[model samples]
Target: MFVIGLTGGIGSGKSTAGEIFAELGVDVIDTDQIARLLTQSGGAAIPAICGLFGDAYITESGALDRQKMRQLIFSDSAHRQKLERLLHPLILDEVSSHVQRSLSQYVIVVVPLLLETGDYDHLIQRVLVIDCDEQLQVTRTMARSRLSAADVKAIMATQVDRQFRLTKADDIVRNNRDFGHLRAQIVRLHHFYLTLAE
Candidate 1:
């Protein structure tokens, strides 16, 4: 089936865009959601995580200690890579399974780190980036995640810059405006994708 890889940096509204596509009756497989499920209590990745980092990174409820792990990984790229190494393959497998089972004309797979990791490149026919101002990204992330501006910026630093990401996009959705504007662009794109699927 035709596949679109949806991506953006932190708080650039990739999830919102994915939701819009889903509302348009497109199948959306979100890697972040898959990752969350795999890191929750009794998740498949828990055993490997505990084996690699020990129980210190696991909460009393047996879920990955997100805050603690975030602090460790963000502060050290080595730790981040280690975690990614352990989880990326599993996430990709699940994404592949979902894509194989999808009944839509086309599928949109949301992978926030699509560009950075390049792990899902083989699975995507096109790349659609949700673009917004850097400051807006920081503000949105800070508001929703309760992260400091510095923390938000730090996360942004790990992602591809706006210009570089835009250069690589097969389609772009500028989400710098209101929800109505965003929806309009998505609707337009939905029609475009439908034509492509045919």
Candidate 2:
């Protein structure tokens, strides 16, 4: 089956764009959600994460404490890589299993860090980037996440910038406008991917 790597910076409307594709009958496996599953209570990555980050990152219920871990890794590169190292393999393995079972013409893997991860390069046939301006990104992210401007800016610091993501894109969806416009773009791109798959 054909696999499309769908990615964007945080709060770039990548998830919304993936929804549009799903509405058009495209299969979408959101890596963010799957990665969460991998780190959840009693998940395969739980023991590893506990070992690496200690008990603080895990909740009493055994699920990962996302906010605590986010704060920890974002500031420390070594801790960040440790977190990625513990989770990436499990995430990729789950993605592979999902892709194997998917019965669609194409599967869009929604990976927010597709470029940063490096583990999924071999799985991607095409890269579709949902893009907008950096200012818009900060605005949207703060609105949706209820994060402070400083918090959003901190997250943006770690990502590949807008121009860089555009440079790597096989297709681009500009999401600075309205959702209707985003939907129309997905419809057009869905047709294109379908044709390619055929």
Provide TM-scores for the models: 0.99, 0.97
Per-residue lDDT tens digits for candidate 1, residues 1-198, read 999999988999999999999999999999999999999999999999999999999999999999999999999999999999999999999999999999999999999999999998799999999999999999999999999999999899888888999999999999999999999999999999999999
Q: Candidate 1 — what's its lDDT?
A: 0.95
Question: What lDDT would candidate 2 get against the real structure?
Answer: 0.89
Please, what are the lDDT tens digits per residue for candidate 2 over residues 90-153?
Answer: 8888899989999889999999989877788999899999998888998999999899989899
Worst 10 residues of 2 by lDDT: 81-90
Per model, state how many residue pairs clash. Answer: 0, 0
- Model 1 clash pairs are none
- Candidate whose lDDT is highest: 1
Q: RMSD of model 1, in Å?
A: 0.6
